[model samples]
Target: MTIPGGELFDNRDGEGRLRVGVLISGSGTNLQALIDACERHEINATVAVVVSNKHDAFGLERARKAGIPAVFVDRTAYTTISAYNHAIAEALDDHAVELVVMAGYMRLLGQEVLHAFPGRVMNLHPALLPAFPGASGIKEAFDYGAKVTGVTVHFADEHFDRGPVIAQEVVRIAEDDTVATLEAKIHAVEHGLIVEAVGLFADGRLEIDGRKVRVLPER
Candidate 1:
């Protein structure tokens, strides 16, 4: 996996928090975790907005309930992927998004958004990336009978689930663990690891080095 070249300024919210835009396509469990972290002051950030490609995504509701602006740019409304992604980028920029987090966002973002945010875009994948990638990651890991699996947070590059890894936590596969159980464990780990990874990014604690992302010691 190649690391995209670029860097972001250390911008802060009015109170020194990071302003983030979360993109999602489903129930938004990870989105909820980030919101909870914000509310608890665990992460030095606030969600500026939440963008969903699916109009009916529960993430939009989650955002509204948290008093965060929620926008849905229906992918079907655009003829091309770049056009759709441009609208998403506009939505994020319009809200002054400093970081873009793919909580459960299913679509691979096009170059429009990738260029718009550069190193500021992050994605959470279900398996230890550079391993099982794509939508069927969890299933693939299970079928492969791996003893251990995990989640990864990485910068979003041009390819799918291929980027410099920011953070990861392992989940040991129990002998009795069914796919459902393994999935639950993976998600549980994701809830925490993703939050930690985003917090690190917001704090300027991450640096890209080829295929490696070094998380710097907190100052």
Candidate 2:
């Protein structure tokens, strides 16, 4: 997909690292993975800020411990979803965020935020998408008795888990594996795959063409 102005958008900071704003609603294991990746220089990016709809979310604590700005935008305070999303966009804008990572963020983002950072939002799903696309992906896949399920990192559109796929890694289910074991395997894959996808975005290697994402050669 072409960018808004038909030009590749580069929003890197002076340090040449992408400014990332991560949105989370839970414990933030994936967010921690990203923080670790940035700390180890595995990715050319930094966690500029973290936003959460719930004030009690542990992800906020994770961000605080990492010294990144953690913002709590209470959904109940806003009268409309648009107002809430605009508030979220405002928070990201305050940090000059170039990429938006939805790491277990429960609410769907509206156009107010999407228009602000077109083609720059990413999300992680527990199951390889086009199969189980919602919050119960792990349980759904396990109940369906699928032999293999995996993680998917993809660009986020207005719809739920229906954007361009960027990266995916399969995890085979062992006969003796319980749902808890399957979930553990999926989470493991999610941590690495999300980091890899973020790294690709930071390196300017991901190009969107229609509904598909292409990874360019390493620079």
Candidate 3:
């Protein structure tokens, strides 16, 4: 099943909620946040599954605790990067996932996987992207002594954190702030920013034009 280019996402799950698959590589605090939002009816979606590239990822435990399917896809199991991406996409497709969310999955997916989902992959970044675009965002921002930093949620293309932004929330950097303090603030905003972005997607309210994403008025 391949999504055609220029197609907007439609939440076609019969359950009346978008079927979402979350990808993670660590503790999955953001995954927990998504789970909480879904349980509280804060979003019109359900996490169909949680997949981790790391077998020891705590996010798998989080998924199991929530009675959700948890899977581990080891990168080394595949000989090629494209093959690995295809494997992950295959799992999401198996669950009939309508929305694919990268909640800290460390690997970059190639066109093989992105083509499967098309414009439906979502990602949350720990910083205001176009500024801090790598793994250690909080530390980089703090070490550089930036005044304001925040969270960004966006569509995921092949590029790393360079997709059209969906939402961003600013966090004021205090005069005497440590990396830990900045990280806490960034995560707090990430938990909500990602939920809001996914909520917009679940409602089929996002339109992507070139590199810009316009969130349409909620129906």
Would you estimate the TM-scores of all the predictions?
Answer: 0.94, 0.95, 0.93
- What TM-score does model 1 achieve against the real structure? 0.94
List where candidate 1 sits over 4 angstroms from the true fold: 1-11
Rate residue 95 of model 1 by lDDT: 87
Model 3 per-residue lDDT at 58: 99
Quality of model 2 by C-alpha lDDT: 0.89
Looking at candidate 1, what is the lDDT of residue 151?
94
Worst 10 residues of 2 by lDDT: 1-10
In model 3, the runs with Cα more than 4 Å from the true position are: 1-14
Which runs of model 2 end up more than 4 angstroms from their true locations? 2-11
Clashes of each: 0, 0, 0
Ranking, lDDT, top scorer first: 2, 1, 3
Cα deviation of 88 in candidate 3 (Å)?
0.3
Q: Per-residue CA lDDT of candidate 2, range 46-129, in tens?
A: 999999998999999999999999999998899999999999999999998989999999989999999998898998999889
RMSD of each: 2.8, 2.2, 3.0
Give the CA lDDT, 0 to 100, for residue 54 in model 1. Answer: 90
